[model samples]
Target: MLPFVLSAALLEVVPSGKVPSSIPTASSTATIPTVMITRGQEQTVTPDWSRLSFANLPAITQSGSLNGQKWSAGQPVEKLLTLGDFQDSFKLQDLNLYAIAVATQMPIKLVKLSQFKLLAGQTLADLALAVPELEQLPVSTVKPLSDLLKSAKPSYRLTEKTLPQLLEQDPTLGALSFQNFDLTGYTLDKLPGLIHAPLQAFRHWQEAKLTDIPGLREMPWQQFPNPPSDSSMSGVIQLPTTMSYRLGKDSTSISGSSALGYQIPCAGCTSITFSDPPALQKKRWISGLAQWVQGGISDVAQSTTHSEPTGRNVFGKAFKVVVTEVSPKQAQTALYFRFCQFQQQISCSPYAIGPVPFLSYRNGELMPVGNLEIGTDRSITPQMLPSVKQILPTIPTEIPSTVNHWSELLSQILEQIKALLHPPATPTA
Candidate 1:
């Protein structure tokens, strides 16, 4: 049933577009180059069937033009069928070139499948059957394989139902990709038969809300190219206790093991009990205008005051003072001070002078308590110092001043503390 005539004599077809006298032939050991069959203007009527001899052929390539294509091969001659009208169609009974290409591990290029008028319900089934050995197929005509296997290439995307079909047809798919699909509400129960599939690698498995897969008792984790980290899978809640799999991040967790059960004991959680006391709350108090101003003046007086040691050896005690004032303008100030009992010891004090309608502290000099350059030389003497009124002139009376003024004041306070703790080195002689 060969469509073209064949003879024992060799035939030669010239590149000048003329049929030659000799036909090309090759030995079984010789490697065969890829063959391309293109539909020309001369061939208009679609061919119903075709055949291929795979005995000496290593590979073949097929392409469909405006007409038709078909092929078949085997001892009884296994036949392949491609049925498409003007476009492309796949038929189980029709032997087409595309079928031959696939069955022979060759390549086939079809101009258009949709252009051909295909019979109802036959196109998908025929294509599926014809390309049984096809490892890669474009998702243009059908849904991607990712939707079928929960694990596919990282970039696989197909309709929800397509995955089941793919899995049913071929369970040996190795890699799967589902980069950005939201599997929020989908559960493992929706897909019952995937446990037997040969899917080993999965990306974005955590994005799928799969609580448990009872059918999947073990995983072929060794086949995973890049397994997921433990943290990636740790967020998955309520996994089956009997299931066990190694995570990509090098941490292994056994489901039914005592270390990881219904309620895992969190270490270092002694202070993390539910019955712990609530954190302490902070308190704030309000003061009248008179009290506020009075407190401020008292603070100024105490800061300017000084004390001397009593002759009876009762250490000199600096006067303690506090200022809490809220002005008519809503400005406020809170200040506190405490004096040391020892003559040589410095006073420890704190002051919060703000909400000032305008006034801010400035620099001033302190008179030493004693003339001797001993341990108490740095101590200020209240007797020799002027009153708070004298120091007020040196302080700023401006309101809403620059923030730098506050910073400078805080810096001065810090410097004073530092000097008290660690006195400046004596000037090098």
Candidate 2:
């Protein structure tokens, strides 16, 4: 399967080698072949074809068919830019790797590519993936990232600006398209700009480090693709079918009252009636692009609240997301965040929380699926204990019929007290 990834870089030098007579040398009908030298080999190679080597090739030509373009179109040939053009090298990820083995002409060897001078601030390491010859260049001649300047360790690196600039230099260079080549140059945080990146047939993003960057979901792009409907890619669109949230701990827990239906209303969703014929379309669009998303966490939403352990707590439910993949599209991943629960949580435990945003392209246009919940784990429900009333220690409250009719007794006692206080009153009493 092809992935939509492309890249660009400097042309490599061809090593010296003896020419195989069967190989065609050029585009014109010349009798004598030309001499070309490669970089790694020790001998020179001579070929019998004209200087117009790949000019007559067709779209699916045996010469080389990359990203649907034949050698006759001259893109691959142009992408194999002259070594003198190295100061502004870009990537060529648009080529269909399976069909990019072009038989070269003589006097024009891959080795000649390495003789070009690099720009002042260019990172030579950035081109190593597309052109492995950079690894052989001496540190003095090929200045890489600042890290290479150190006397201790001399590992090279490309900056966030590296890829974008390379693509800017050559529009013909594919941005991230190497299917078989290794892209050790790019890091998780240093993704190439999407606007200049080329569309690919099959792309595997799992290899890139994408976990660290923030605001990844909202990156800008000139064009993006819609998710493909290929069943094999369905896993890429994983979303929660039902979402459950546990707000407060223990006695102070809050649970859905069932009657209200378990869901937090999505903002601006009041106008939507998801009835059978549905008042709203399942997808949303802005500009000419369709909206597709992978995440929508509470933090990215309107707001959220705190929770305590024992008092009445706010409990609510949110709807799960369902994402359908798009096709021929290059998607951009914008980051939200997540508290991983089941398998792996981003921040917290027991429940996975999040809306990890990712843009999908269909036919190279962004899919407008609206805010999607990209990350969702198991539904977590709080454990609660039954409530009980306290009882006083066993003191008997039973009384017989003769128990206390103190009305008469109280009157007698009052009279006796009065007589004692006053002697005349006592006599009358």
Model 1 segments more than 4 A misplaced: 1-94, 99-110, 123-126, 134-429
lDDT of each: 0.21, 0.21
Candidate 1, poorest ten consecutive residues by summed lDDT? 308-317
**Residue 288, candidate 2: C-alpha displacement in angstroms:** 26
Writing each residue's lDDT as its tens digit, candidate 2 over 90-181 gives: 11224211112221211222212121112111233334343433334443433323233332233433333343343455443323222322
Model 1 residue 402 distance off true place after TM-score fit, in angstroms: 99
- Candidate 2 ranges with C-alpha deviation above 4 Å: 1-134, 144-271, 274-376, 379-429
Angstrom error at residue 410, model 2? 48
lDDT for predicted candidate 1 compared with the true structure: 0.21
> lDDT for model 2, on a 0 to 1 scale?
0.21
Per-model TM-score, in order, reads 0.13, 0.19
